[model samples]
Target: MTADSSLLAQAREWHVLLHSGRATAADRAAASAWRCTSPAHEQAAMDVERLWALLGQLGEQPASEPAAAQVRPLRRRRSLRWAVPLASAALLVLALWLPQGAWMSWNADFATAPGEIRSVELEDGSILTLNGATALDWTISEGRREIRLYRGEADFQVAKDSTRPFFVEAGPARIRVTGTRFDVDYDGQDVVLAVTQGQVQASDAQAQPLLVGASQQVRWSGERLQPLQALDARQQLAWQRGKLVFRAQPLSEVFTELERSQRQRVIFLDQSVRDLKVTGVFAHDDPQAVLRAIESNLPVRLVRLPGLLLVSRS
Candidate 1:
């Protein structure tokens, strides 16, 4: 194997060992020493770790029978100690090489690539405006209409269809409405529902249904649904117009939202800097310029690199 490929393989091994909850002090020290060997080593480790997280969010499954059968041989042949290493390596390789469109096409009825927004018209007269990096599917049958928000955000303008109640399932929560305009944003963990017109009822795993009126928002996670808060729904949905508005939010969250607005990944190298609050209006057309503006105001430094943007405390 090439030197770079060898480094990536070693990085994957280190990643699995460290996260296995069985790493000894010596193992950690060895991993640290290996990372210090070269910048390439450190980058490889970081890339693999991030890719693992991304795959988890994208619902990565176990290896297929053929792939599993390949590992079975390493167990039988004691001399070939490549199973564990190859497993993690294979996952990282798939993450790196898999066509993102294929992954989305397999599951999502409709999806938008990173930095791309789209609009869809349901079988009913309802309209959906998907935000960047969003994926959703809908089922309409037997006087029932349901939409599932698998990732990212979307704004819905429901058609007045009282016969078939409209529902949106996001994460661990559900929003039920009949002919109402609202926005749903699922960030893998929490689902935020913002109503622009009319009202909707929201419920999560641990909470009863709650009513949310126009210009109000509610957040739901696996735990419970939060009480409604008043906010400008139009401002929240400004991403539809290539703009983003953050009101005294954490720098980390700002960067996270910025990632959804663009194609590249953003990494916060300094956790302490992330807690810094930021409030600004950013145009999504130029993410790099937005980062530059952030760096000018905050006590953080930004490093622009291909495929990754690194943030650290100044």
Candidate 2:
């Protein structure tokens, strides 16, 4: 491997060991030897360790970020009591995990306030429209453009950067593009990608590419991808407009939509109505309007309680 490639590989191994808690005594000694060999090596190892610490605290991260090591969340495993025991020696070995690395700055984060839409002017002068209540992190470093969506969503009007392909990550999927106008909906396990113009490819961090075209939408369920034709692209991205638009959308999808809009939380007493389809644009501010619309059309009942709303099949 080349010098840069070798360093990158070592960096990745260090990261996996630090997070997975799967590193052995031999591995640590080798890592320590590598860290002491050169300043660059030490910096790389410390950087990865620190990153894990910070991630445990906030469940968010970015490139070149200073990591906090003072706080490490306990590995949450309900079945840990049944696992093999490692005794005191294992605990003592981990005691040397000194807190190291730089603390990241707030300025490194890209956030948009609720009900406020912001546009980002990229280095290439291309515009990115950030929808309300969005938090994402991106970097253009070492001839690579990377965008990691920690939370919320973004509408990209990508400028062509063939030299450094623009990439957006949401949940388990990464979107790669040369240039395109697309909307990425990242709701944890499911990432719904819609391309209005140009083209983009969706894949896991290490998987084959799935090309998406104009007026198309696809979702990644971590293990596999399902493509759906754009029957209602507007509804797919109504959050950007402060509205939830549905056109003969399934009743289940409607409840999901209502849950997204309700300030508190909407609960459905009946799951049977979830399969029924409803069509309309419901103003987000007063979700009661949508309920009323649903009431006027479907054979259903709406029950409004303190801080919660319910949809039931009549």
Best by lDDT: 1
lDDT of 1 by residue, 38-86 (tens): 8888887876677667546434443434655668555556334445445
Best model number under TM-score: 1
**Candidate 1, after superposition: displacement of residue 162 in Å?**
1.8
The estimated TM-scores of all candidates read 0.67, 0.55
> Candidate 2, which segments miss by more than 4 Å at Cα?
1-108, 111-116, 122-126, 205-207, 228-232, 237-243, 259-262, 283-286
lDDT values for all models: 0.76, 0.64
- C-alpha positional error of residue 313 in candidate 2 after TM-score superposition, expressed in Å: 4.3
Task: Report the Cα lDDT for residue 103, model 2.
Answer: 17
Provide backbone clash counts, one per model.
0, 3
- Kindly report the root-mean-square deviation of model 2 from the true structure over all alpha carbons: 18.5
TM-score of 2: 0.55
lDDT of 1 at 14: 91
